[model samples]
Target: MPDSPKEEVDETGGPDLISFADMPDRLEAAGLTRISKQRCRQLAEEDPAWPVPLDKALKVGRMRLFDWRVLEPYFRNRTPRQGQRTDLKPPATEA
Candidate 1:
């Protein structure tokens, strides 16, 4: 029987490995932030604080793959903390 397109064999020819193209959707499905390939690449280039490190990306020919298990924590940590606001001003006191 032929495997489904979504199911990719790993180097050891074990269970299915998630593909890079499907990463964003997987992240969303897992309740993590959804980031596109372009966005991931952009962050890698521009942001030193990017959650997923470039080294984590596995290059297979022209495709780039990632492990969701490894990335999930990073995404969760990236969320802004409660009560944290960039725009805030103190109220003026009556003179």
Candidate 2:
């Protein structure tokens, strides 16, 4: 089957732009990280390394589209946050 409009690459020969709503599933389906829409939003808002959205200034809708090219690497190389590690032992208290 032919690709849909949503799947077409842009003139820059880059991957199709995607919204946060579909990003998590798309990345997960591609064997990347298992992320949520809320996490995507948080990363976009808090992560300095996040790619700038192509339509950041457009206020017409709540949809913010990002470039897949940049995001793919980000997700592929993402490491777990330090606070998420479970191997650390609690500090001993001196009596």
Candidate 3:
């Protein structure tokens, strides 16, 4: 059996670096991250932050690309763990 275009691997014997278009599914499958291309675009429009700048996407031709190694941490951190509250609570009101 031969590898499909989408499954092509690199010299490192890992999946080839992919374009932003392919990120959502790949990230989910790899258990590395979960972000839609649309969400990624939205993030790209926002102000920069630390560690991984969600908006810092690179362009190759007309396609946007992101390094999985760099993005994995951001996604992992964003994902809400089981039975854990990921949202912030409002401050207590004063009487």
Candidate 4:
């Protein structure tokens, strides 16, 4: 067992540890698709499915560190949304 549950083993028996600051790179490394830090913050703020931090008391400045085990499933099963806004479609041209 790790000194902290935040570094605990995942369900798959692999080491699971991550920080909010490193989330984008870690997600990209796992082939889960990269996202911006701003997007990460958005998810943390707006996404209900976002995993809860294992160590809520711990903080790196204002950002919270999270367990990778908890996040892996969320990102892996995330529904892909269109990159462009649906309402932003250009006006149809007359033939």
Q: Model 1: clashing residue pairs?
A: none
Report the Cα lDDT for residue 69, model 3. 61
Output the better candidate (2/3) by lDDT. Answer: 2
Question: Could you tally the backbone clashes for each prediction?
Answer: 0, 0, 0, 0
Q: Which stretches of candidate 2 lie over 4 Å from their true place?
A: 1-15, 53-60, 82-95
Q: What's model 1's overall lDDT? A: 0.64
TM-score of each: 0.51, 0.63, 0.51, 0.63
Residue-level lDDT of model 3, residues 11-80, one tens digit each, is: 5876345566777887789766567877666655552532345345565777766666666566666644
Per-residue error for 44 in candidate 2, Å, reads: 0.6
Candidate ranking (lDDT, best to worst): 4, 2, 1, 3
Tell me the tens digit of each residue's lDDT in model 4 across 45-83. Answer: 787777673345246676576767778889999996757
Write the residue-wise lDDT of candidate 2 on 2-27 in tens digits: 77666346877865677888888889
Write model 1 residue lDDT over 14-88, tens digit each, in one string.
534456567678778877777886765565666667655667666788766666555566667775334555568
Residue runs of model 1 more than 4 Å from their true location after superposition: 1-19, 80-95
Total clashing pairs in model 2: 0
